[model samples]
Structure formats: structure tokens, C-alpha cells
Target: MKVPLEIRPGSDAGLGYVKYGNGPVHVLVMHDWLGDHASYDAVVPWLDGHALTYVFVDLRGYGQSIALTGEFTVEEIAADCLTLADQLGWGRFHVIGHSMTGMITQHIAADAPSRVTSAIAVCPVSAAGNRLSPEALTFFASTVDDDNALRRLFKFVSGGLSDEWADSKVQHSRATVAPACRRPYLDMLVTANFVDDVQGLATPFLVMVGDNDPGLDAKAMQRTFLAWHPNAELHVIPDCGHYPMQACPRYFATVVERFLKRHTT
Candidate 1:
């Protein structure tokens, strides 16, 4: 059973979260782009007692949470997450973020080393010279309007193994909350940057990527970026895609469980 919790940052804005297990350390889990806390759905059940408490949920503008007033920037999302942590009384916790959220997790770690015990990013978005394929850019352009019916071309661009998964992730993600989240989020993200210096990263770090991910080079990138950190490690999942949370959750869960047990003091 999932225990639901709500964090109201202010007027008209709230974030939804779930707490699983009971342990000395709590985990602040972030989802990939176009995903909610549900991104961790497949892996949560198995976390049981091993992790003490595993917290995963939708951000301010995704899933059941309401976006804040005015524009929603990447910084805003970051602030909201930190605020949520404070509200939950998690002065210190482990963080596990996927994709865009992984980037944010690093920001948090850099900003507050005392509060973060460890960090994990599964296929983190590129912070430096990140380039999308021409095909991907074209597909993103075509998805500007939500059509009455699903488009096959869109499914191909979104990186799902099946049209069903692609459509569901996109449609639900787009329709989840306020539109400001994207405009501001994108603006802030494009303007800001990330660097993978695990040595600099006070928290122990774990980075994982999937074989099906275009280029499947997240591991290489992680290694190049995090090589300086003695505690940094990387893993590449075979026969999987960008959506490894749903694609091969068993491996995902194991990696997370091990990271937590070994690092968290």
C-alpha cells in the first residue's frame, strides 16, 4: 500500500509524495522528464525494509501536485524539492533522481552537502554540449499540438518500445499540470549547466544508463564526468531504453538498494 502525503508550498500549489519503509535515512527520489513519482512505481514494492524510508512523488507541476504561481523554472523545481524535504523533516537523506531530476539532485548535493548522504542518477541529461538528434528535434516540433488521436511519428520520437507506453507517458505528462512548468523549467535548464565531478560531489554517486538509450553513452559520459570522485560508480543496463524505471525495474531496484546500504551512514 502507498501512503500518500501532500506538501503545500504556498497558495494554490502543492506536491504529492509517498513514503515507503522505515529507516534512519530517507530518500528523496526524483522522476525523469515527463514522469511523476509513478516513475518509481515498479521499484517501490521491493524496497520494503531495506531502505528504511523511500520517498517518491510528483513534482510541483506534475501528477497531482499544483504548480506554483507565476513562471516555473528549473530553479523553482529545485526549490520546491528542497522545500518538500524540509516539510517532511528530512534534514538529511539520500537522493535518487533520473534524467532531468538527476541533474537537480546533483545541484542539491553541491548546494547542501550536509543534507545529502548519497546520490544516484539514471541516465542524467547532459550538462555540457548536450545535443539532440536532428530527428529528435523534428519530432519535438511536431508534438506542439495535442491532437485528437495519437500520432505514430510521435511514438517513435518519444523513445518507448511500444506506441502504448509512448503515448501514455507523453499524454499524461503533458496534461498533468500547469503549462508554466515547461516554459520556465526549460528556460532555466537551458540557461543553467551541470558538471559531473564526483570527486567534488561530497555525496557518494551512482550513475546508470540503458543500452537502448540513443547512443547508449550515459555510462561513458558518467565515467568521463565522475572519474575524479573515488566514490563514483557507473552501470549500463543491457537491452533497455531511456525508461529503465519501467523497462527493467529489477536491476534498477537492486542498484538503488545496494547504493543505499553501502553509503548511507
Candidate 2:
């Protein structure tokens, strides 16, 4: 069954989130750069709700937290997530982060290793960051307001997926994310480096990437996530690109749940 989107508004000190399921396992799922929590809507129906509960969170200036603003740094995001978890009365929980937020997951785990049970990073930017060149950074920053540019960028990451899909994603992003937050968050994605904080982290991590993802591919995972964490494992989803939750929801849920279940005990 499709889970209803129930938005929980944030307080002055917390981020807003959508709660799903009533299961034993608690999971905090964070969205990527483009869209909000709604980005995971495609995989909601396939989720094993009977065994797992998910809290889909909106970062500052996104979705339910659209009115909120912040420093937009990884440390700030990690702190916000921890604050949200405490508000939800979750003592220890699993975390799942997609794209840019995936890097935040590392920070969360590092900051509170005892509280985060395990982490799943999907097509994530590494802690070392993308380190984009000045010109490339300018090109990406320009896409914040340009629909066509955003669509083209999504298309490339999705391995030349259909225009219809890219368009839908762009529209969703425009609707949910505030334009002012994009550049600041993009700056963090391309330049922030905190590999030193997370290196040798013992918290288990499932580093998942789409086989067709040209940027954060399996090889990239090997050199970054897998190399930095002692208890990390890599899984490449077949016939997929950057956004597997959108492109292959069923399989994505299955893989995610399987890993989550393994560490639940």
C-alpha cells in the first residue's frame, strides 16, 4: 500500500518530517539535492512497512521546512537530523541518505556513532566532496533558476533517461525546494571536505549506486565510501542510473530493506 504523506512541522529547533509505517525498525530517510522527501515516493509502496518505520525529512528550505533557513553546511545538516531524531523520541535509528544528503549521513554517523545504528548512502557524494573546478561550479550554480539547465543535468546523471522523467523531476524540485537555498547547498556539495572525521568509522554502511551512474559510480564508491569506512559494503544496482528510487523502485526497496534488516538485530 502507498504510504500517506503526513508532514510533521518543525519547531524552532528541529526540521520537519513525514512519518511512514509503524514497525519496529526506525529509519531516518533524507532526500537529495534536487527534490525533497517526495523524491522517495516511488519506493514507498514497496517498502516493508510491517518491519520498518521511515521518517522522511525535509532539510532546511525544502518541503515542509521550506520556510526555515540555515548555514546549509554538512555539520549543520547533521545537527538538524540529530535534533529531529531526538524530537521523534528515537534513541537509536538507521539512516538513509540520497545524493548530497548521503554525505551528511557520514557526518551524522561520525558525530553520533552510538545513536546511528547503520547508514545507507545512495548515489552519494563522498565526504571528500566533488571538488568541482571554478568554471564547473559556475555552470552548476547557474542551473539553480534555469529549468532547462537543471533538466539537462538530471538527464546526464540519470544516464540519458527519458525527457519525460527528467521533466517530472525538475518540476518536482522547483515545486518543493526554495531557489535561495540551492546555491548554498550546491557550494557545500562541491567543496566541503570532512573525510578526516569519518575515516575508519565502524558504523556499518551500505554504499549503493546505480550501475549506469557515470559520476558517483561503483569505482567512485571504491575509492571513497568503501575505502574510508571499515564496515562499508558496495552494491551496484543494475539497469539504473543516479536515481534508482525513481527509476527502479521495487528493486531499490528490496535491496535497501535487505541491508537494513540484516543490521536490525
Highest TM-score scorer? 2
Name the top lDDT candidate: 2
TM-score of each: 0.81, 0.96
lDDT (Cα atoms) of all candidates against the true structure: 0.65, 0.91
Question: Candidate 1: misplaced stretches above 4 Å?
Answer: 1-14, 133-138, 141-160, 194-199, 227-230
Q: Report the lDDT of model 2 for residue 113.
A: 94
lDDT by residue (1-265, candidate 1, tens digit) is 4543333233353466766766667888887655677777778656745446777757766665645454555556667778778877888888888776767777777777788898887777544423556775445444434432225543542355776777676676667645656544544544456564323665788878876676436655555447644567787778776777787778778878888888867
Clashing pairs in 1: 22-52, 23-52, 199-229
In the range 19-91, model 2's lDDT, one tens digit per residue, is 8888889999999988899888889989977778999999999998998988999989999999888988899
All models, RMSD in angstroms? 3.6, 1.4
Question: Candidate 1, residue 256: CA error in Å?
Answer: 0.9
Where does candidate 1 have its weakest 10-residue lDDT segment?
Answer: 4-13
